[model samples]
Target: MLDQNTSAQLKTLLERLESPIEIVATLNGSDKSDKIKELVTEVAALSPQVTARFDGTNKRAPSFGIAKVGEQPRVNFAGLPMGHEFTSLILALLQVSGYAPKVSDEVLAQIKGLNLTSDFDVFVSLSCHNCPDVVQALNLIAIYNPDTTATMIDGAFFQDEVEERKIMAVPMLFQNGEHIGQGRMTLEEIIAKLDTGAAAKDAEKLNAKESFDVLVIGGGPAGNTSAIYAARKGIKTGIVAERFGGQVMDTMDIENYTSIQKTQGPKFAAEMEAHVREYGVDIMNLQKVSSIKGADETANGLVEVTLENGAKLESKTVILSTGARWREMNVPGEKEYKTRGVAYCPHCDGPLFKGKRVAVIGGGNSGVEAAIDLAGIVEHVTLVEFDTKLRADQVLQDKLNSLPNTTVIMNALSTEVVGDGSQVTALKYKDRATDEEHTVELAGIFVQIGLLPNTDFLKDSPVELSKRGEIVINERNETNVKGVFAAGDCTTVPYKQIIIATGEGAKASLSAFDYIIRSGQ
Candidate 1:
């Protein structure tokens, strides 16, 4: 049910509609269908022009078939529009009511000019913050093109559909029953994808099984540097990465990357890719390294890196530049409220909580940095740390303290994320020093605890790892195993900065070259 203020706002917004909007919900007597019908009815009752009808006997089981009245429905939703996805539902209603597309004129013109009869089936969860961006973008395109139909499939209510599609993440898109990419993307990016038709082609096969003089795992700054160094030596080089940008894609600001005064993560990632592509390095993106074997001379000497999809790459030497990711707090309600109110990347989701109070759970440099960056966008930031003192740099701490909207609370451990059924509302924490419990009422939570190396694939390998699970390496970037090396935050590098990682990657490539020369590979 809508509150008085929300109902008033909806009424006002509906008054702008020049035509009637009809929503037909197909139900199958499930609890999810009941909730969907209730929500649609509640929202439709706010305006005279808006109407909702429910059908309980439909064989579709549970889904919303929405379209303008007196026309065949072109849109379908399989889940309840709750959490951040409620915005998508509202936008769908508004668009059906004759709201103009929010995309640029160029994009709309390109979409309108499209001759392909496209069907976009988007899968999303209710709590996904990134889902609405993709849904709205696709819906706007559908509004522009009469031949295009956009469908929103809820990942929750349609568990079978999710499993069938092998969907591991939200915002997974499909074009005419073929799987596209995942995650939120801009309209321009989507259009470029459609124009290129790369996903449809690339999804069929990754690459031919090829051998390289040196192979670099991961695709961050370190991996790119390693590939370039190897390729420059006139050696057959290949770089296989899960994502081309690695963890660097999530980074919003970079000021200490040597000469660059300022750069965003995606921009830097694109630059790195462009630079790497200039060489003959056989770059394989979107492949996960499952395991490594036979690095020793006694066992064929060639290192074979196996992928999750049963593909393998053989190389004389392998450099592990797999990066690190943000550590999770692993508290209660964390998973349930993810993207609803519990968010990890401040740069990606901060704009959604504009003028809303939020909490940052950490006191390290990353935490303070997130707080500082979010302070300008959000109304207030409550920084919670388990340590008695903040571990961030003095400059960052000073900047954070200078902000009147920021509050630093030391010796506090985040215990749980509290939220309503639809969205997050507050955060619960415990004071380690006083043994007292406290709660902060906020709209969102930004977690920047620390870094965790993505090195689980090396657990069974002979490459020695530190107690902290980081690959142990010498100054020359050489691991204990022969012809195997590592770099970046995943290694025992003293400083986990991008510049240091890049240098280490270069050194690792040189070391691999030296090993190759000595071993006569």
Candidate 2:
């Protein structure tokens, strides 16, 4: 129910939004083309007060925030007005349409009802595209309560700044400017982080939160395995993952991992997570490590992991299963609306989309594989390829073609993904030949692009990352850095498979144990 005051504010915002918003379309470094002028006129007519203008001043790279200077707003005219930013425009509309800086009673009430009003900052990188959903949820809280402001900064773009803050991974959250948690978190954990009560923290014994016996940085097969092992070994472990399952989470069917003929990706992830939980692992979901600084080893020879959370954790051993993320289109909205409708793994969220329509954006083996799998669940699967022909293996291509609900859109380029918040609605495509335009209504879009290692955080750390972003190590999966061992998709190994990651996990554990013995600990 809307309060009278809140309703009035929303209505006023709606009026301002309906009153013509200005957007200018311009081609950078080009002569003043008539097309630019015509489009600017079209945008001006949409907003009563907003006017479109193009200046040749050539704006600097993206600044901290959008700057407005005098009557003329800094002009950046993107020609064709298409692609990822399309949704950004929509978001701007909604934010303004519902704008009431002071917020409403229900929201205000929720704020007053919070366990804590302290602010938490989460820093993330574009590489960790799986994080937008987490950031958005935090942003929602910040909306209702101005005391907390959760903002996401591109770690790569602001590498120096992130380093200053000691950020090692993406989606890492800070609690009251302190390190409250890391990795994946249940709703309960989230509320705990939001907890302002004194009793709960005392019961939870957060006084020991600053110390860890083992710090496991990946939530995939290896990291999960290590966490379970460490917890059983009676060493408190903190597992940090951008998303709990890493690249494997993006994978569909897992017939390779031991003990199961075949299983869904997320189910496997959940099981691994369960195994760790049964042993009481301190797992922080959606947690990204921004940086790692170590204190002197304890008397027992445990390495201390000091994360960007401003908390110092004493861990005897650190496992590097930090894993990798899918390679993206590098377009705008891809980063903004990743989990909303744009997904990476088909199997994890595929079942929830039964009978819905969707599209797959790659033509490689993974792309074809995703389309074929999605066809079984979704009503229709449109496979869009930018290249002239499919690049997947002939066998996979044949399988994709055999699927009834799958349609191949070759020689097409996906210029834009349009959606209405909660889910994706349409995808705009363009042809390279006759310049034909195409659009398809899709409920979900899975990107079968590729992957990159999450090693940007190990910059000055002792860990040695491979050229391809995999952690460089010896035959035992041990890195050049002492007391550091890496495994899984982020390692310098060929053939990315679940079984391989698990094997490496066992190997890494054994090696770590051996390292401990050799030191006479």
* Cα RMSD, model 1: 11.6
Q: What is the TM-score of each candidate against the true structure?
A: 0.66, 0.54
Which candidate number would show the highest TM-score if scored against the true structure? 1
lDDT of 2 at 97: 30
Which portions of model 2 miss their true places by more than 4 Å?
Answer: 1-185, 189-213, 228-252, 277-287, 294-302, 336-341, 345-358, 373-380, 386-393, 403-406, 409-444
The per-residue C-alpha lDDT of model 2 at residue 319 equals 81
Candidate 1 local Cα displacement, residue 291, angstroms: 0.6
Kindly list the per-residue Cα lDDT of model 2 for residues 127-219, writing each as its tens digit.
Answer: 332344344445445544435544444444444555455443345567667865433343334643565552343334433676565678888
Tens digit of per-residue lDDT, candidate 1, span 344-367: 777556655668899999998999
